[model samples]
Target chain A: MKQYKHHTLSVLVENKAGVLSRIAGLFARRGFNIYSLAVAPTDDQKFSQITIVVDVQSAPLEQITKQLFKLINVVKISELDPATSCEYELILAKINAPGNNRASIIELVQLFGGKIVDIGISQLTVMLADSPTKVDDFEALLEPYGIIEVQRTGRVALAKQETSSAKLRSISGKVS
Target chain B: MELTGAQALIKSLEAQGVEVIFGIPGGAILPVYDPLIDSPLRHILVRHEQGAGHMAEGYAHVSGRPGVAMVTSGPAATNIVTALADAYMDSIPMVCITGQVALGSIGTDAFQEADTTGITMSVTKHNWLVTSAQDIPRIIKEAFHVATTGRPGPVLVDIPKDVSNQLMQWYWPDEVDMPGYKPTVKGHPKMIKQAAKLILEAKKPVIYAGGGIIRAGASDQLKTLAELISSPVATTLMGRGCFPDEHELAMGMPGMHGTYTAVTAIQKADLLIALGVRFDDRVTGKISSFAPNAKVIHVDIDPAELGKVRHPEVPIVGDVGYVLTELIKEIKNLEKKQDQSDKSAWLKQIKDWQIRFPLTYDKEQTKVIKPQFVVETLSANTPEDTIVVSGVGQHQMFATQYWKFNRPNQWVNSGGLGTMGFAIPAAIGAKVANPSAMVWAIDGDGCFQMTAQELVTASSEKIPIKVAILNNAYLGMVRQWQEMFYEERYSEVYLSPDLPDYVKWAEAMGCVGFRVESPDEVAIVIEKANAINDRPVVIDFRTDSSEKVYPMVPSGASNDDIVVDPSQGQGGM
Candidate 1:
C-alpha cells in the first residue's frame, strides 16, 4: 500500500487573468488532489502568492513539483516543511448558546485564545486564528454546544526567520 | 510612429522575421487584411482555417521557426482548435492570431463573436485577448517568445475589431520581462558526468532519441554521442529523421509497427539513454514491462516529462542540443574507454534480429498494388533532399516504416495527435518554406478527402507540392483493427473508389491528376507527377484495400507479446 502525506507548497506566480485557472487545470488534469488553497496578492503587485495543501503519495510528490514548474505563469515554488514553518488557520463557528452551555463555551473559547465576534439572542459567533491543531481542538470543544455553522480559511504558512548570528556566519563563510 | 493596431501587429510580425503567414480573411479581421495588402510578408489564403493552422505547423516543423497563422473570430477560431491541439500534443512552436468581436459587444452575442481565449485555454501554451491597441506590439512579441521557448507549443492572441482599428504609438519592446518564463538551457555538469559514467559502464546500451532532437537541432550531437560510445540508436516515430536511417548503428523506429530489431534492442538493453522523449504510451507498451531491465537516463527540456510516466535514474532538464553537447564533453573528460569486445555480442544479437525479421510485405502475391510497395517505390524515386509528409493511419505507418529518412526534419507527420487531414496543407507549407526542395504528402484515401480542399490553395499560391494518395478505398487502420479484434465484423469503413474520382477532383481543383491501378504504371505516374513543377500534382494509386500494417502490438499489450505477422499466428515467435 502507498503511504499518503500532506504537503504545503508556496507558489509565486504572475498576477494575470486566468493564471489561477491554468494552475488549477494542470492539477486537475494531472490527477493531483488539493486539500486546501489560499491565493492573495504579494507585496509586489506584479506577482501573487498561492499556498496550497495537497495530500499525495510520496512517490509522486517530485513529479507534482516538476509539473508545477512547467506552468509559465508560476514564478517560483517552495515546499514548506511543517516542522520548521509557522502555520495557521482561521475558523468562524456559530454556536447555539442558549443558557447553561454559554458559559462553558466562553471558557473553552478563552482557553483556545478565541474571541466572540458576534452575539445574538440565542447564538454566538466565535472566531479563532491559530495553528491548524488548535483550531481543530477548538472545533471539537464547541461541538457539544450545538455548533450551527463552521467556515475555515485553509492553512497558510511561512518559514521561521533565521538568527542574525547564523545569517552573518553563513555570509562570512561564503566570502571565505 | 503613430499607427493603427493592425498596422502595428503586421510590423511586429515583420520585425520578428516572419516571412509568410497562412490564413483566410473574414469580416472581423478585415482591418488586419487591409494592412497585409501592402506588407512584404507573403500570405497563403487557405480554404479552411484548420488548413491554415496545419500549414503553419508544417512550416515550423521543418524550418525550426515559430509558424504564424491568422483567422477571424467565432467559427474561424473554433475551426482551428484541432490544429492547435495537434501542435500542443506535438510541442510544435506556433502563433495563431485570431480576430475577436468588438470589445463593446464581446459577451452580447455579437455577430462573429466567440470566447476565443476561453475555448483555446487548455489547448494553447498561453493565450491573450488584447483590449487596447498599445498592447499589440508587446503581446505579439510575448506570444512568439512563449510559443518558441521551453518545450515549445502553440500560443494564441485574440484582438478585437475595435482594438485592431484603434491608433497607438508603435514601439517594439527591447526585452520580454516574464519572471516566470525562464527555461533552463544547460544541463547540470554533475548529472551529465553521472550519465556518462553510466553509459561507459553498461555492456548493452541503446540511445532512444525522440522529437526533441529535431526541435533542438541536436541530431549531430546525438550522432556524435552514439558514435563516441559505440552504442546503437533507435528513434521514436517523432524522431524518425533525427538520425540518418542509413547509419550502421541505426535501429529504425521502436514501438508498435516499428522495425523488429529496434523494438527488440530496446527491450533487451541494460541501459536506455532517452533523449527528449516523453516515453509516450504508444512507444512504451504496458509501461510496467517496458525496458524492465534498463536503468534510464532521461533528458528533456520539459521538467514535467522526466517522471510523468516512467521514472529515470538520471533526470536532466535542459535543451537536447545543449545537454548532448555537454554529455559528449563529459564522456571525453572522464577518459573512460568503452570495451568494444563487451558490446560486440549485443551488436551481433541486434544484427541477427534485423536479418531474421526485416520489414517485409508480400508484393508479388497479388496483382493489386500494395501500399507498402507504393511507399517504397515513391521513396526510391524521390530526390535525396525530399521532405515526406503524411496524415494519420496505415499510410502513415507504412511511410514511417519504409521511407529512408537520411536527414533531420525530412519526415514530417502528426505523430502525437494522429490527426488526419494534416497532409495536404502541411505539404504545401513545407514546399512554401523550402521552395527548391521536393515535398510529398503521402496520404490514405480516407484521409485525403478530409482536407483535400487545400490543394486548391496550393495551386493558387503556386506551391507545387506532390500528393501520393494510397487509394485503399477504406479506413485501413481501423478496418484492420476490426478485422483482427472485432471478429472481422467490418463496420462503416469502406469507401467506394468510383464514388468521387480522385483524379477528377484534383483536376477540378486546378491540379494535374493521374491514376495508377497496376504496379507497371506506378513509376510512370510518379515520374510524370514529379515532372509537373508549375502546378500541384496528385497521383491516385489504387492499392490493395486488404493490406494491413504488420509488426502489431495490440494496445496495452507488452512488447514481448508483439506479433510479427498475424497471418502466421497470434502467438509470438
Candidate 2:
C-alpha cells in the first residue's frame, strides 16, 4: 500500500488547561503523525476545535476520535473532507521601500487592498488578507520593490456551516 | 508596541523556547547582533556560517527541537545553503536568519548584498524577506511555526540591514493566521484498510523505517507494530537506533553499504512495507532490480514522496507512525500466520553467504592496517546509545557495517545527498544536544580534510565528541573503482602528504588526540576517548588504503548479484 497523504481532521477538545498539549501528546505517542494542526475556540458552548492534516491511509478515524475523547477535556472529534468543505488561509508581508520608491510601493499596496500598518524612514509595513495563494501572489508583486522581511501563518480552517464537524465519517466498509 | 524589530525577533524566539543560537557576526547583521548580545539567548560564534547551520541541524536532530542559525548577508548567507539543503532533505527542523543589505542599496549591486531569498527558496520549505519592522514579531513567530510543523524542513528569513536597524513597536500575538500552508494529519480509512489487507495476504513481509519515525516521535508505535506483526524491520542509516538493534525482527540498515543479511532479506521479501522512508538510492539500489518480487507498500507524511521513486502497490500518504498503528490494529484482528514456519531456506542462504564472507579483519596480521578492525573496535567500545555520525566513503561504510546501533536517532550521516565534511560539525551538534550520549564522528582521510576546520568549533563548544579518523592513506572507495574498472591505473587518487597526526591536530585545537597504529591499541585508545567527557578528542587510526567494503551490489545491480567477498576472488568484469 502506498502511503496516504492529505487527511482532514476535526478534534473536539477540552476548552481548559493543557488540552492542546494533551491532544498533541496523543498524536505524538500514537504515532498518528499529523502534518498540519490548527486549534482554536469554537463558536459553540465552551468547546475547542482542532483541525489536523494527517498523512494516513484508509483507517479508522473513530478510534482516533474515541481516543481523543478519552482525554477529560476532549469532548468530541471528527475528520473532515476538504473536498466537501471550504478551506481558507490568511497571510501578511512587510515591504521595504527605498527612499525614492514610496509612491510606487503605495500604489502597489492599494492594488491588493492591503493597508500600511507601519511606516518608517526606510521601511513600509504592508498587510494583506486573502487565501495563501493570494498572499504568495502579493508577495511576488512586492519582490521587485525589495522585501525586507516576511512572516506567514500556515492554513487554518473550520467545518462547513450547519453541519456538525464533530461527527465521524464512515469509512469504505472494508474494516468490517 | 515598544519593542524594536530585532528585539521582537528575540521575543518571538524566546516564545518558541529557543535557548541557543549559532552564528557568525558580520557588518550587515550588526543591528540584529547588537540586540542578540544583550538578549538571554546564548549565541555560539562559529568560524564559518556553514558550520553554524549544520550545528543547528545537529542540535535539532538530537534534541527534536527546531535549531536556529543566524548570519549576515552575501557570502555568509550563501555558506549556510549546504546545511539548509541537508536539513531540508533529512526533514530536520531549522530556522536560518540572514541580514541583507539596506533597502536602498538592495538590487543596486550593494556591497555585501545577495539575493538570499531567491537563492534559498528552492532549498527551504518557505522563506520570508521582511520589509517593515512592524511585521517582525509576527513573521518570526510564523517562521518557527512553518519550520516545525508538518513534514519539518528548514525555513529562511532575510532581514534587510535597514529593517533590522528600524525602530518600530512589536506586538506578540497570542495567535496568527495563515491560509496557504495546511499540512494533513489524519489517515484515510480506505488506504489504511488496503495496507492492512496487503499485510494479511503477504507471506513474507518487512517494514522499513526512516528518519520520520524519530521526527514524529513514534519510535514506540513502530516497535509495537513490528512486534504485533511478527515481521522483520530494517532501517535506513538515518533510521538506525530508532528501532532497538537487538529486536528479533530488527535487520539493521540495507543498501550499498548495508548489512549483508538485511539486504538479502529485503531482496527475498514478497511484501515490503516502508514507513516514513523516501526510496533513497542508497536504500534502493537500481530501482528496477530492487525487490522485483515484493509488493511495495509505502507510507510517508509528504505526498511528494509517495510514488517519486518505485511505484507502490499501495501508497498510503500519511504519517509513518499513524499508518503503522492502523495496520497493526487490522493485522491483530485476523492474526493470520502465513509463514510461521521459519524460512530456513532463506535464513540458511543468508547464513552461507555470511560464512563465505564473514565481516572480518586479520588480528595477527603484520603489515597493513585494516579499516574493518578500527570500525569493529570502535563499535565494541562505543555504547549502543552513542550516536555515530559518518562522512561518505570507505570509513562511512565501515562504520555502518561495524557499529551496532540499537537506539533510534543515534546514527546521523548525509545519505540522500552524500555530502562530505558532514560528520565533524554534526557530531558537535549531537554532542550539544545529548550531553550524556557518546558521539563518535567517523571520518575518512579525504572527507575529514574537507571540513577539518570545524574542529575549532567542536573545541570551542566543549562538546567533547570523539572523532575517529579512519586514516587509510588513499581514497579507498575511489581506488577500488579504479582497480575494478580502470585496471588499477591509480589516477589522481593519491594524497602523498603525510597524514597530519590528527592526535596533535586535536591538541592544536586545545583538545586531546590519540593515534592507534596497531589493532590491539584500537580498543584501549577508543575506550580512553570514551572515558573523557569534558572536551572533544580525535583518534587517527592508521588503516590500510586498499581495503574495500564487500557484499557489493554495484550501483544498478540486483541483490542476487551481490559480491560477498571481493578481496578473495580475482578481479573480473
Candidate 3:
C-alpha cells in the first residue's frame, strides 16, 4: 500500500492580517497537499496558535515541517497524531426554500443535532458541528436545495486530557 | 540628566561595552539611528536585516559576547526570526532590537507596523515591548544581561517609534533588577562531585563537547579535562571545531553521518560525560540503542533540557563555564589511577572501518569528479584553524565525513535547520568576526544557488572568504534516493538547467574564480583561492552526480541500522 502522509504543524503566529495568506502560499508553493488546517488562539502568555494538516509520508512531512520551521514567522512545528487528539469542525450553510420544503430543511438540521441560526423568507441558515469531512457530506446533502454561503471553521484539535506534552516527555524512554 | 530615549539606549549599550552592532537603516528606527550616528559604538550596515542577524550570531560565536542586531519593524523583524531561532537552538547569545509603531498607534496597523512582541515570543528567550522612555535603559541592560547569561539565546526589545524619540532622564545604572529573572550560577556541589566520581571510576570515559564549549569559551578547559581523563572525545555536529580536531583523543563528529571513529568510540564507552551539548536525534540514532551501556553524566546550563532526552545518571545544571570550573576542583580531590578499559579494541574497530571505507575520490577514473576531494584538499590547504561554513545537503555530509576538523567551531553549518544558501553569507559573517583567519564556504551546486547574492556582501565589505562549490549536476540527495528506493525514477533531480557557471558568477561579484574538472585540480585551485588574500574566491568543481553520503540511517531508523559506503557495498556492522 502507498503511504499517505500526515503532518501536524504547531505554528505560533501573530494573530493578524496576511498571515493565513503567507501560510497558504508556503504550502501551495511547496507542493504540500493540505488535508486539514486548524487555527485557534493558544493559552500562552503571547502569540496565537495555528495548526496545519498536510497529507504526505513521514519523510516528506518531516521535510515540510523543517522548511516550515525555517519560515521567519513559524515559531514551532510538531507532527501530532490524530489518535492522540480530538478534532472538530464547524460549518454554516444557507439553503433556499420556497414552501413545505423549508420544513424539511429545519427537520434535517434538527435531525443532525444542528440549529437554525438565521432565517429569511427565501433562505434559511443552519449551523452544524462535525468533522471537516462530515461538513463536506452536509454540504452535499443541501446541494439539491441550492445551498449558499458555506463557511467552515476547519479542523480544531486538543489532545486527549490525560496525556499532555508533559506525559509525552518520555516517548523515547531514554530521557524523562 | 536630560536625554532622549534614543541617546539613553545608545549610552546603555555603550555602558554595557557594546563595541559594534549589525543593522540596516530604516524609517521606524531612525531615532536609534540618529543617536547611533554620533555614538562611539561602531555599526556595520549589513546588506539585509537577515544578514545583520547572522553576522551578530557569528560575532557572538567568536567573541563569547552577546552580538547585537538592530532593525525596523514589520518584515525586518520577521526577516531576522530565522537567525533568532538558530541562536535559540544552539544557545548563542544575541540581542535583537526592532522599532515599533508608537503606543498610541500600535494596534492601528500603521505603515511598517507589526506586532513585534507577538511575532517573536516563541523564538526568543525573552522579549519586551518597551512602552515608557524611562524603561529604555533598564530594558537594554536586561536584554543584554538575559541574552548573555545562562542558556544564552536571542532576546528582543521592541521600542515604539515615539518612545525612542521621547525625551527622558538618562542614567546608566551600574546594576539591573528584574525580580523574576535569576539564572542558576552554581551547580549543585553534590552533582558536580557525582559527575567527577563517575569519570574517575569509569574505565572508558569520553567527553562529548558541544557548541556549549564555544558559548562558554571553555575550549582550553575542555582540552585540559580531556587530557586529565586521558579519554577519547567525540562531539555533536554543532560541536565540531569546539575542541582542536587534531587532538589524538579527538574523534570527529558522531551520529547519523558521524565519522566511523567517533561513532564506535561513543558506542564502546562505559561512561559518557556530555558537557554543554544537547543530544540531538542526528547525534543519537534511535535513542534506545544509543550508548546503551554507558552511564551518562549530562552537564548543561538549562534546567529544562536536563532529563529531557537520554536521562543522565547525574544532571549538573548551571553555566557550562561555571560547572567546568567546579568539576576541575572536584577532579583534584579524586585519586589517580591507570586507564584500564583497553579502548584499543574499540579504537581498532573504528580504525578498521575507516581504512576499509576511507573517503576516496577516483584519481585515475576521472569522468565526473567526486565532491569529497574538493573539501579534503580545501581542508588540507586552508589553515588548520580556519573556519569552514557549509550549505546543507550531500556536500555537508561529505564535508563532515571527509574533512579533518581538528579544532572547535572550525565547521559551521545549519545543522538543525539544514538551511540552503547558509554557507556563503555565514562564511562572510565568520570572516567579519575573525579578520585574520581564512574562512571557506563548502557549498553544493543546489545550495550555492540559494543565497550566492551574499557574494556582493563579501565583496563590498572586502571580507574575503573562499567559496568551494561541489558542482554535481543534480540534487545529489534526491538522486541517491531515486537510485536506492525509486528504481531510478529520477524526477526533478537534474539541476544542470538552472545552474549558472559559478566561475563567471564569482567574477561578476568582483571576486577571483577557479574551475576544476579533475580530482587532481582540487588541491591546486583551492590553494589558489587561498592565495588571493585581498578578495573572496570561488572554485567550482564539476563532480559526479551519482555519489551518495554513506553510513546513512534512513530517517528515524535506529543507530544500528546504518548503510555505509553504498558504492563499495561496505555495509555497517
User: How does model 3 score by TM-score?
Assistant: 0.74
DockQ agreement of candidate 3 with the native complex:
0.03
The lDDT, on a scale of 0 to 1, for candidate 3 is 0.77
Compose the digit string of candidate 2's lDDT tens values, residues B39-96: 7998878878878888898888888889899999999999999999888888889999
CAPRI-wise, candidate 2 is incorrect
- Report the C-alpha lDDT of model 1 over B247-317, residue by residue, as the tens digit: 99998998988877788888889999999999999889989999899999999999888878898899898
Per-residue CA lDDT of model 2 for A75-121, tens digit only, reads 55556666555565555666778779989889888987778888988
Candidate 3 scores a chain A TM-score of: 0.76
For model 3, what is the alpha-carbon lDDT of residue B155? 91
Clash count, predicted structure 3: 12
The window of 10 residues in a row where model 3 chain B has the poorest summed lDDT is B335-344
lDDT of 3 by residue, B368-404 (tens): 5777766777777877678878888899888877778
Q: Is candidate 1 or candidate 3 better by TM-score?
A: 1
TM-score of 2: 0.75
Q: Pick the candidate with the highest TM-score.
A: 1
